[model samples]
Target: MIAVSLLEEYGGIIKNYKSGDFIFEEGNRPLHYYQIISGEVKMNNYNDEGKEFIQGIFYKNQCFGEPPLFIDQMYPANAVAVIDSEIIIITKDKFLDLLKNNSEISLKIIKNLSQRLYYKSVMAAEISSQDPEHRVLRLIDYSIEQLNFKKEEAGFLINFTRQQIGDLTGLRVETVIRAIKSLEKKGDLKIINRKVYR
Candidate 1:
């Protein structure tokens, strides 16, 4: 997102998003692509039966709402901040215009998209074969990928409830509990004080 922004003529607005705030609702017209500057955001869906499910959780610097922008369509899911967050909202006109004008930015965006596609493919493959515990581990791994390593709080930065973990991993709360217990017994992780196990 930052790469694509470099070519944009118009600068985006930095907006504050409180926890539990929705940036957009399902089927709302796509006006901008948003990049999370801080905290976590969740893209979620609801069935006709009123059961809600999370499509994805996005962390700091992660981008969402782009694919819909190009098609001039409504957002397919709701974008909500799981934590208090800051974001850059770039309008589609300006964002796409920038890409057309800047070769470097276009290349960078393409490269980034390619890597994202690969990650998504892997996630689809593994989610079917792996248990929830291992799937949670993979989420942590992806979330922390490209970390500086020397930075403090280098372990788990976002402390999530078992329910939220369940939302991401498609596990029920009880199943999530059992999976964590399994990891704990293996000495692979420890969940203490309801904070984290990594």
Candidate 2:
């Protein structure tokens, strides 16, 4: 992500959002580059039955919704604040100018996008052909490695809730609960005080 001072220099403005607020709706034209300053945001799409499939979760210092800006395409999913959040927004034109003026940040952006693409590819395959347990484990391991989940004395703490895990892995909440319990039994995971560890 671009440094805050640099974003400010490029005319970035901070905006606050309440929990459940929509940062952008699906199919909307990209107008700004958004980078989180605090709290969480999730990109998701709901099916005809109103079942949400979470595309991704982003945290502080992470940027979201850049792919559409780069391609001049409408957003494919809605971005919602998972909690009260502060975000820095830069006008699309200004953001482009910043990128043009800074090669190091541009390379970082490319690397970030590549990581996202890799995650999507891996999860797509896992969701398509893997069992619930395998899918859940893969997600936990990936998050630990890529998302920087905090480590505790017991193990690496999994920050995702069971419901979030299901949404991300395309499993039911009950399935996620059962899979976690199974994983614990198999010595692949641990549940300490209801928090999952790996």
Candidate 3:
């Protein structure tokens, strides 16, 4: 992510969003580059049956919805604020200008995008072929390594709720609960005070 001072220099403006607010809707043209300053955001879509499938969750300092901006395409999923949040956004044209003038930042952006692509690839395969326990474990392991989940005396605390884990891994909430319990029994995970640890 670009430094806050540098983003400000490139005409980035901070915007506040309430929980459940839509930062951008599916099919909308990408006009801004958005980076979180605080709180959580999710990119997701609902099926015809109103089942929500989360594409990704982003936390502070992370960027979301950038692939569309780079490709000049409409957003494929809606970006929603998971909690009251502050986000710094710059016009897409200005963002491109900033990248053009900053090679290091541009390289970082490329690296970030590559990481996301790799995650998506791995998750796609897991969701299609893996069992519930395997899918859940894969996500937890990825979050610990890539998303920087908090460490506790017990182990690395998983920040995702059971519902969020279900959404991300394409499992039902009940299935996620059962999988977590099963994993705990197998000594693959720990549940301390209802929080999952790995």
Candidate 4:
């Protein structure tokens, strides 16, 4: 994560967005660098049939939309606030300057992007050929690693909803529900108080 103090020192302003607000739409020109100060944001796209595919979900202290900004290209996916959120944003020029001046931050960004690329590759394979249960398990494992889910005495808690899992793995909600139950029966995960833990 980029240092919050550095952003504030560099004149980044906190902007509040209501849930369901479009932070940026697909095909829009990139203009600012954004880091979530609080709450959630998701990058997503919809198919012809109106089915939503989530590209990624970002939470507090996470940054999004940097790849397009660096490449000077239009946004390839839409960013929406998943909850009432506050984001720290700086002008594109300032953001570029910040990265150029901070080797540590730049290296961190590179590492983060590399992890994202690895996840994308794995998920692509799962979506292409894996069975529903396998895909769901892979997704949960990936989220545990990437999101740094804390493991308790029971297991690692999954914070995502079933519908979110469905979108991420290209499965229907009903399929996700069934697969989760099957996974639980197989001792792959545990359900407590209606929440899934793995």
lDDT tens digits, residue span 1-198, model 4: 988789977779999999999999999999999999999999999999999999999998899988888899999999999999999998898988898999999999999889999999999999999999999999999999899877988899998899999998999999999999999999999999888999
- Give the alpha carbon lDDT tens digit for every residue of 32-93 in model 1: 86888788888888878876777777777778766677778889899999889998887888
Task: Provide C-alpha RMSD values for all models, in order.
Answer: 3.1, 0.6, 0.6, 0.9
Preferred candidate (lDDT higher): 3 or 4: 3
- Off-target runs (Cα >4 Å) in candidate 4 are none
Assess every candidate by TM-score. Answer: 0.80, 0.99, 0.99, 0.97
Candidate 3 lDDT tens digits, 12-129: 9999999999999999999999999999999999999999999999999999999998899999999999999999999999999999999999999999999999999999999999
**Native-referenced Cα lDDT, model 4:** 0.93
Task: Predict model 3's lDDT versus the native.
Answer: 0.97
Candidate 1 lDDT: 0.73
Off by over 4 Å in 1: 1-9, 146-158
Provide the clashing-pair count of each candidate structure. Answer: 0, 0, 0, 0
Cα lDDT for residue 131, candidate 4: 100
The residue pairs in collision within model 2 are none
